[model samples]
Target: MSIKIYGDPGSGSLRRITSAAAVMGVEIERVNIDLFKGESHTPEYLELNPHGLSPVMVDGDFVLYESSAINLYLAEKAGSDLAGTTTRERYEILQWMFWSGEQWRVFATLTFDEVLAKRFMGKPADESIVNLAAAKLRAGASVLDAHLAKHDYIVGDRLTLVDFDIAGPFSQNERTKIPLNEFPNLVAWQQRLLETVPAWADTKREVDVRIDTALEAAGIKL
Candidate 1:
């Protein structure tokens, strides 16, 4: 079974799906879509994904978009322990996945647009908008930090697709200077994730470099 993943480096969606595949011991043929140059908007790419989003997954005749969806699909395909073995476990995994997408992703996108896009891509930055986004982002992190304090992983004791799904956006928060120090549990959780996940550790340096460049361009000192 051949799987293809199209994404730009350092995108949270890319990290989520790729890390999921790695954890499942699945090898995906990567197709790099250059978001830096609007490659995702090209006619050919748009034909594949009308939304023009990165982290598109193509398996045989089936094609899917959205990072969370891709991660779940890979986990299901691989029967990875992360997908959960029971009905309740599956529900918990889905719950955290939804939380990550609805809550964390919204805040991260706002910051990316208000800060990184403005600074690095020469777009306009709205100070009020970013401040609001920062507030919401911190609020969400607080909740996550509280939950993580009691649990080693998002769903129960073992790592699941939930952990992989949330890690991408949460890790990006550090890059955006969201002040994770306020959430000590989250800081420790991220460190533990990096230590346990080989894929995350392998990509850490590259991810940090990319985030640093973007943050620096935005005048956000790490």
Candidate 2:
């Protein structure tokens, strides 16, 4: 049976899982859970994920929540080196994944929320909020840039689950205004992935379209 993924195409975390599936050539059926319509909070949907988050995965009777874990599981099942072939590699991969979510992504989302998300809702961005978020994002980017200067990918020299986990948010860099101009290595790394990974490029293309459609529906011209 094909794995089923429950999430909106506009969701960054959902995109991460789908991009990994694309890279590994895994077939998946995407089920839309409209956050705006409160579909995720419905009783039936909540049963799959108590937190009511997007991008839950169901492969037969097994259900998985959290994007990073789901991607790891998919990689392992697909026998892709994206999961890491050795224990040390696996731990290091997990380290970057955790850091991606806990340290880096939080600020990225904050900036996106204060800027793009608010703009979509016909709201003005608060300068204080946007500035704070951008500052944090820059600090995180600096660390990532320094690391990336020495390594091609987040965990190691090759593309892995950690790359997908960390780079997913950067797909919104144009819309969210992520400050990466000064980080040449990080910018170059992102460009390399987009150019080399057909799956990621395709997934990001679909995401861009969805974002545009959403913006049009909201009568917001970009």
Candidate 3:
């Protein structure tokens, strides 16, 4: 069966699937939906993802949206251990992935708006909002760092889809200046995952290429 993913390279959410594909050596069609140009709201894309979000996946007739959900599905479809090998392992993986979305995503978005949006997109950032977000983000980062200090991976000693869940946003720390210096374990965990996983490196390079292509096509420089 063929798989198709619709997203943009610069998207943190979309990066989850693209990087996973690179790790698994999975062949999936990539459909660029440039939110920069309001491509996600167009009729065709809205039909595919009613929420008009990035990283929508279509496997045969099955349509999936939300990057976290798609990560679980992709692992299952590929028979990859990234899904985890047993009931408890799978449950913990899902739990961490869900927390990444429900809990951590808010902080990621906040930092993106306050740091990256202002710096890259020239959008105005509200200082009050940035301060609020930073406080919350720091609390969560500490807990994550503590967890990482105890375990090499989210579920077990192996890299799973949960790593992608946690790693994607951390990768943006340099760009967003999200204050990860305090979370050394979290920082080191991300570094180890990227360095050890060949597929992850492939995904990073692929994303760079895609971003360059899109930027050039849009006459935007970064």
Q: Candidate 1 lDDT, tens digit per residue, 147-210? A: 9889898887888878876777665665566555688888888889889988877666556676
Q: Which residue pairs come into collision in candidate 2?
A: none
> Tens digit of lDDT per residue, candidate 2, span 1-222?
989999987778888998898888888999987765678889999999999878899999999999998988888888988899889999999888888888888778787777777886678878897788788878888999999989998876999888888887776777877786678999899889999988788888888888878778888764
In candidate 2, stretches whose alpha carbon ends up further than 4 angstroms from where it belongs are none
The lDDT values for all models are 0.79, 0.85, 0.77
- RMSD vs true structure, all candidates: 2.3, 1.7, 2.7
lDDT of 3 at 14: 78
TM-score of each: 0.91, 0.92, 0.87
- Model 3, 1-222: lDDT tens digits are 779899877777777788787676678899877766778889999999888778799999999998878877877777888888999998998888878877787787777767554544656678788787778778878998889899888779788888888777665665566667778898788778879987666666666676556557755443
Which has the greatest lDDT?
2
Model 1 C-alpha lDDT versus the unseen true structure: 0.79
lDDT of 3: 0.77
TM-score of model number 2? 0.92
Tell me the lDDT of model 2 at 218. Answer: 81
Q: What is the lDDT of residue 160 in candidate 1?
A: 84
In candidate 2, residue 83 scores what lDDT? Answer: 91
